[model samples]
Target: MRTFQHKVTINDMGAITIFGLGAFFCLWNRTNSLMVILGCLLIIVTIRAVDRAIHTSYVLTDDSALQIKTGRIGLTKHILLSEVKSVEKRPFAFHLGHYALIEMMNGSVVSVQPDNVDSFLSALKKRIEKKDNEV
Candidate 1:
């Protein structure tokens, strides 16, 4: 099995910095109730980004399954090679940039943006093709 780490994009860094700074400024001058609430929100967002950076990963298993693990809620989704219909590069709906989109035979789609997207896609495609040939 191979595990691919999540890519820390410019947007991710920007969000973390912005939220961290905002939280610091808000909490530093906590004279108003609204500022405290906003500070707490900012801290939550910053922590979420950190958690995602630390925990999100893609695992390709020897049994032809791709496991997508997400942080915070610890959600995991597994996709079998035989269930994958196609793979393409497109703008991810939930993210700021492009990612590898894997479409399943049942019409579900999963997006993945690994640290080395090209290598990840090539490896996944090769596995899928090999699985196809075997069937």
Candidate 2:
């Protein structure tokens, strides 16, 4: 019956480093300047996307509702507690860094990267269990 909420911050060191190296390479090897510039831009955009993903927060209430808020597009999605068919805690996967995927009854999934995923999963499970017992 606990309201669990978590927010995760994006770490930009990797992106920044890649962009810097790409810039350096672009200047040093002018033969492929366009490719290097494109790589750098791609890295920058990837960083921004990751930042948006990480900045998102998830809120789970005792009523079985899951709410997510992403900073970039100012979009918030709410999934009813009964709508979530399953909650899966996935470890760091390919290109996912480290995040969790919540699957809904409709077969749609939402990804969330919380700072403490283990704790988040534990709390979510506990709440769900409690709710089930109440019914």
Give me the candidate number with maximum lDDT.
1
Residue 91, model 2, lDDT: 60
| lDDT value, residue 6 of candidate 2 | 43
> What number of clashing residue pairs does each candidate have, in the order they appear?
0, 1
- Which tens-of-lDDT digit does each residue in 16-124 have in candidate 2? 5566676566656767668767767766665665655456677776568777766555587887766667888776535445567888778899877766778877877
Evaluated at residue 107, the lDDT of candidate 2 is 89
Ten consecutive residues with minimal summed lDDT in candidate 2? 1-10
Alpha-carbon TM-score of each model against the true structure: 0.83, 0.59
Clashing pairs in 1: none
Name the regions of candidate 1 deviating beyond 4 angstroms. Answer: 91-98
Q: Which TM-score value belongs to model 2?
A: 0.59
